[model samples]
Target: MTAPIPTVFIGGNHEASNYLRELHYGGWVAKNIYYLGASNIIWFGPLRIGGISGIYKSHDYLKGYYEHAPFQGSASRSIYHVRKYEIEKFKKVNSPIDIFTSHDWPEGIERYGNTEQLLRCKPFFRREIENQELGSLPNRTLLSHLKPNWWFSAHLHVGFDAEIQWHGEGSTPYPPADPSKLPSSVPTYPVQVEKNQDEIVLSDLEDNSTDDDSRLAKKPKIDAGGEITNHNEPGCNIPNKEIPVYPPPSTNFYGDSETTKFLALDKCITNRRFLEIIDIDTGSEETKPHTFYYDPEWLAITKCFSKYMSTAQGPDTIPSNIIDEKNPDELEKAKAWVKDNIKDYRILDNFAMTASGPPPKSCNPSTNLNRFNRPKFNDTYLYRNQQTTKYCQMLGIDDPFTAQCPENDTVSK
Candidate 1:
């Protein structure tokens, strides 16, 4: 007799929706075992662990949470697929997470490291490689922004490993288009706007005629030496002293160029590479150095979700007074909002297009039994269990999954 080893899991596209929904924030799925549901980030000592549950599809990316149990028509789609608002928590935190996981594979990741080896191993995936549609586009976008040290994914039932090199801030680099089709001069703006939530109130400012306004118009006094002096301040005669300068600080947590080791495991039933044992040196100077800083550009991209989602969802959620004909002022405000959020809307469109290769494939959720509702017990769970039991039998051990014990022995305090 032996104690059962604890296991943790994140849900995939095929899961018991009701069961997962009960412990959405990831309560224990089994004794001493846990589930990391939806978009959850947790910590284990120095290691920061995070995961996004469920598969990705364009339409399902930005909606309020929905789930249905008992495998109803189309209801299971909402129940299993990752929702739009689920990722909001990720946008709020800018810390460098150590590890990340998802159910669906990240799209176009094969191009980063070694595709030759990948194709040689999984020749059946050649079509997906050619079309660049093997994995999730939203996952690619998130991976680019988060730049975690490692990423693990499943659902493809294939054992694969690769390194995805971070290409730095902004979108992935694209090759130049046709010279004739390109613009004569690329549009360049002198000022680049950094987006944030600070507002400057122009109403508070006044012309020079007002007493408060006079302070704004005041000019600094310039001496013969060409050094400017502040005339308004009383203590403006402080002597200057030279201070020691320090070297520029590093802005990396891992002390190395951000690159993620991505691994996808095969099904346990396959009895081949079913699990991976990795050693993460959390205390190493090369890994756990404390100079990590969040990339603000990536944060901005994450925070833009609400703006884009609003546009994609349309003005139905807009206030009735703002959209209704009764109040013209509010209606104008709503219109202005729509116009202002157009940039984010367009950004989302471009992101989806670039990541997924094409628009998301349209399949009827209600009628598409292959894609949505139909569940296979043997493929998902039972077959794996049976295979494990058979393996145990070959080794002359009792089937751990069904080993019987005395009633007194099974009793717990």
Candidate 2:
């Protein structure tokens, strides 16, 4: 049987960590279904899609993936939290992105959309919005760093839209000459700029590739530094590095200053706007309409940094001085390696059931556990799936999540 549509998803706070851990490099979870891994950049036709799975928790953000199944205490919950290792990896991207998704909304995003209406619809969010502490801070940074044409998120459970216009320091987001014509409810946030903070360069995206999608076309050369404002300077300590920063693309398919469209959706339920069909123009560059490939640069970054992954340890293994546009040799070498090693870049719609289904309803052979099973606090066994082994072998990197599970002890978390 064949599925009607293709679906790709990222991890949220709640997921089957035990199973998801197997395809850590992102693989077909099922026929027509793809998991985007911990953090990844995948290509669908002319669209370059990238994202990081998991929500944010400052403590677990830098610890790497150290939790195992039969999770104890808060391990099950904390295991799905976002990590710095993945966040730092995205900072290495130097190409234009078409779409980016995240499980949680970016922090400070409330300022860009109409907060008052959001509060009216979901009043429970008022406290968090008022305290200015809603959404993941790291993801917010990634949003500013990788200014994709379209950004979609799903944590807030609301139908909202906002346009973020990337502008220089002295530029205004909108024309100040006509405040009277602007609707009061147009934004729940104010167009104010942050003052007096150290800035870090995110990308020096210098691509000259010819594509019909103006957003992905050859970008004009500009100054070599772009800055994303840092709000929560406490829990987030962005490393200072020397990377080139360029302004948003001068030409856009929409025919305006380079901007990103942000949308957040609720869960699909009766009378809820959870499902949205977005229409996009792939330009004249798409070879196939229903195919996706690996982003060469992202693959390069992944292969280059795969050795630094921390599956069962503290501290992020990826060095602070990671490769960026300034370091072209390392990236070129990895890209070259990918071309030589990865025979087919296309992501085939194929799935393999490498393991058995969950214990058939509680840990009992008679029945399996429910989504909210009683979490164990001490068992920390790891299962190495054949999918992960092959993925690592192909990438030429050591498999990080290879702890052995006990014999005859077949309980899935």
* Highest lDDT against the true fold, candidate: 2
Distance from true location, Cα of 84 in model 2, Å: 0.5
Per-residue C-alpha lDDT of model 1 across residues 230-339, encoded as one tens digit per residue: 42232221111111111211123343326787888765543345577888755444333221112222223223332222312211133333223333453334334433
TM-score for all predictions? 0.48, 0.70
lDDT of 2 by residue, 1-413 (tens): 34568778898765677678877888887788789988888766556678888877655555768777766666776677787778767877767777899988877776677765564444445666776557777877787778788888886556777778787663324321122321222122333432111111112122334211233113332211433312111212111111111211111222222777888876544555677788865454324455667666777788888878876646665554563355656656887887677766666555777555555343673234433453333234455566666777877887676544444443333
lDDT of 1 at 27: 40
**Candidate 2, poorest ten consecutive residues by summed lDDT:** 235-244
After superposing all C-alphas onto the true structure, candidate 2 shows an RMSD in angstroms of 16.2
lDDT of 1: 0.47
Distance from true location, Cα of 257 in model 1, Å? 6.2
Q: Which candidate leads in TM-score?
A: 2
Q: Cα lDDT for residue 57, model 2?
A: 63
